[model samples]
Target: MDAPALDLPFDAEAMLPGLRRWVECESPTFDAVAVGRMMEVAARDLALMGARIETVPGRMGYGPCVRASFPHPRAGAEPGVLVMGHLDTVHPTGTLPALPWRREGDRLYGPGVYDMKGGNWIAVEAIRQLQRAGVATKRPVTVLLTSDEEVGSPSTRDLIEAEAARHAVVLVPEPARPDGGVVTGRYAIARFNLRATGRPSHAGARLADGRSAIREMCRQVVAIEAMTTDAATYSVGVIRGGQWVNCVATHCDAESLSMAKRQADLDEAVERMLALRSATDGVSLEVQRGVTRPVWEPDGKVMALYETARGIARSIGFDITSQSSGGGSDGNFTGAMGIPTLDGLGVQGAGGHTLEEHLLVSSLVPRAKLMAGLLQVA
Candidate 1:
């Protein structure tokens, strides 16, 4: 027998107003008050969708998180679908006023529009459409909107993991790839503070007595850059050194990141960074580990989930493909726990975390329909 029909009634065009509002809010990750305000806006909307909204207190000096559960007619929260996203953005609070929201052709440009305020609205629109059709989802659906994802999701990681443990699959709408693909796996990332300490002396009068920390740091930077290969990377992003050119640098500090395609590769990269020795005779090198995100490799279960989602997408006039992303998301955390996850299921767009960020307006409805179909099916 043929499968029953599915009618996804979300008007993609009508989503502009709400999305525009979210973009205008400017909920930057670093601004506590602004991020909290944005969460309130989302909480009100989620409550209107018959969801039970919970305010999870923010940790480590960040804004609060919103947990909205839209229960199934029967199952409630018993092993359902988990939707993950963030209200926090990389742009500051004043970015919206200067950048503003505008559309050129099919691209909608604004702060946080593509990096994922648009994707977040896709979830809301999906729920609204289901309610309008009087369609009950197959299982409970939980939406997690955190306030600190752009700066590494430090506050929301534990909460996200705890919630994901109660669900079977995690759907991360982290803005679909501009090339029309979803994220199946992501690279692991490790950050570090590389500090070099050395004796300071006058550069001109006692050059031989001076042990330059900046020179040692430059040598370490060269070594780290040499370690960058196809499968792994080590790049120094920021550096600081002596105050004056006439004095030997007493201390030097640098921030670097290591990215790897696999756990073993990441481990190797970290080992290399930690083992780095000072080049100057009197300089000492120290590395302090900062934020680390595990690689989300495509395991059996995650790939299986993608297969089901691909079939649904094909039925809706779009043949979806799954690909690996170099950037990590919250999916990396859950995937580390061996939970099935599919990231980048959001609207298609380009230039995330940049001024040119935009969403392909044409993708709104079809992608929303695909998401609704996934939720309705399971």
Candidate 2:
């Protein structure tokens, strides 16, 4: 098996220090300065792989993006492969002190390790190994590490899509499924905010004159809940209204979200939600559609890409399987753009977006090898 499996040139244990360095950096999505620091460190590491690295200013008001271009050995015929990941984590600042980066037995625990920072290193290590082996990539490889993915990729969607459009394939090293599965399709997500407006009046003193926005929202909530069915699921996460028990609420707001397995389901669900109007005579409803991650539905070409990757894994003496994700990634944008994309190609880990997040130390070498092999051929 040692000979059959793609042997890593460098000891996998050596990779842990870099992982720790990244985790300790604490690059949360909301902190631009912190995320920028993380990107700066990543740019240096990516530059070591003989890539011409550049920092793209964050146009979406997030942190700057790090793009590393590895020139192909051969002149460009078709667009090369795009290796993409995000630098942002759901964890806020000061999380490292609380969770801390430490290795116990076979697990590395810290913020951002499992969700994505680990994935970033895996991709970087793959390229590092490739460069060390003197193997020139057949196609140019561009590694784009965006700073705002955990918060919905507001600044990087266009960048990811534009880059993927030119590439033959988009390789996203998002964290692997807890069971070591990769991802082929991801659900479309649309965040929504519904606000109800009404006139305020003293509840007890002028009960007949009051039209409660909270009551209007309550009626609309029934319709919102009903919108969840087999194909699409919807839920309201937050609700705020009313000043006191004696006063009718002039305003009510609800933060809701919907996820669909298909595009039609997403569109239909959004339309229905937006159609929700005032249930009370004097109340009015307003719907605002927030960040939307389009569905990454697997088509024939993408399936073929998956099959190719499955074969690559087989060559390395491992069985690779892919699953569909309810959550979305930058892969969604590329997949929606009809680019051949593969995701969850990063570290094998669980407990993403939690203080318990960890990456399997044993998975580092094998997953990195898989990425290297894919880069060599794809």
Candidate 3:
């Protein structure tokens, strides 16, 4: 039997104005006020689409989260679809001057434009298009916009899990892969904070009397990175030490991250990282565990959901492939819980978390139509 026809006039050019507004609002993860403002903008848009808007208060020093629910004829009879995306970005608030919004060929460049404000906007626009066509979906839809995804969703993990528990399926519009693919599975990730303490003394006059914490930290960094294997990898991205050049450093701090393809491998990697000790005689090393995202290996149900999306994309004149990613997103929580999840359903471009972040302008309409189709059936 032929499926019901859906007539949606999704215009890429018409989408630019709304997307540009979202991209220009800089909401870095650490800045709570900025994130709240971004939420206001999204709340208004969601309200315009006849969704019940709820602004959940932020906890743990983060900003608020916006939950928008669309009413349905069978609202409580079954679980609904959860469309997830994060509003917080990695770039700071003052990044507009250097990386302002501009159109060059097909790429639309701006802060948070591609790495995910564009994707979130696209999802909302999809629902609006469906409403304009007067099409009712099989299930109800809810949109959850979070505040802290760039730093592993520390403040929002519990809320994300709680929300996902009530949903039948999850769709994460994080950035689409460079080849316009989707993500079925994501690797496990763990973060650690490292501190080294030692005695302080003059560098020139009493060099032997003092133990340099900076030197000890450097040694530990090298050893930690050397622990990488075929299944796991480690990197120390941030380091700070030494108040003065002439005096031996008393303390040094660093942050490191680990990633693995499997849960067992990541567990082993975490154990190895926590077991690190100071090789220096008078220096003490401390390792504290931080936020972690467990591995989300796709199951049969996840694959089935992907197949549905693939069929929808095929009808839209574009085909999408699925892959496993090393990066972590909110989908990790839901997918790990054995729920059917489809991720990486976002805008197409490149340079996330960098100055060249952008999305392809030509991809807007097709991707929006794809998302609209999914909302209609899946």
lDDT of 1 by residue, 1-378 (tens): 012224666687799999988889889988888999999999998998888999998878899999998867655526988899998998987787666799999988999998889988997898888888777777788999999887678788899899999998889888887677899899999988999999999999999899999999999989889989987998998899999899999999999989998889999988888888887788999998878898888899989889988888888888888888887788889888898998998989888888888899999988888788877775
Q: What are the per-residue Cα lDDT tens digits for candidate 3 across 1-378? A: 014323588888889999888888889999999999999999999998899999999989999999999989888789999999999999999999999999999999999998899999889989998888788787899999999999999999999999999999999988898899999999999999999999999999999999999999999999999989898999999999999999999999999999999999999999999999999999999999999999999999999888988888888788999999988999999999998999999999999999999999987887787788888888
How many collisions between residues are there in candidate 3?
0
Q: Which residue runs of candidate 1 sit more than 4 Å off their true CA positions?
A: 1-6, 75-77, 200-212, 241-249
Stretches of model 2 off by over 4 angstroms after superposition: 1-5, 75-77, 198-223, 238-252, 280-282
TM-score head-to-head 1 vs 2, winner: 1
Which predicted model would earn the best lDDT? 3
Encode model 2's per-residue lDDT on 125-165: one tens digit a residue: 88888777677665789999998888678888888887788
Angstrom error at residue 331, model 2:
0.5
Scanning candidate 1 in windows of ten residues, the lowest lDDT window is 1-10
Of 1 and 3, which scores higher on lDDT?
Answer: 3
User: What TM-score does candidate 3 reach?
Assistant: 0.97
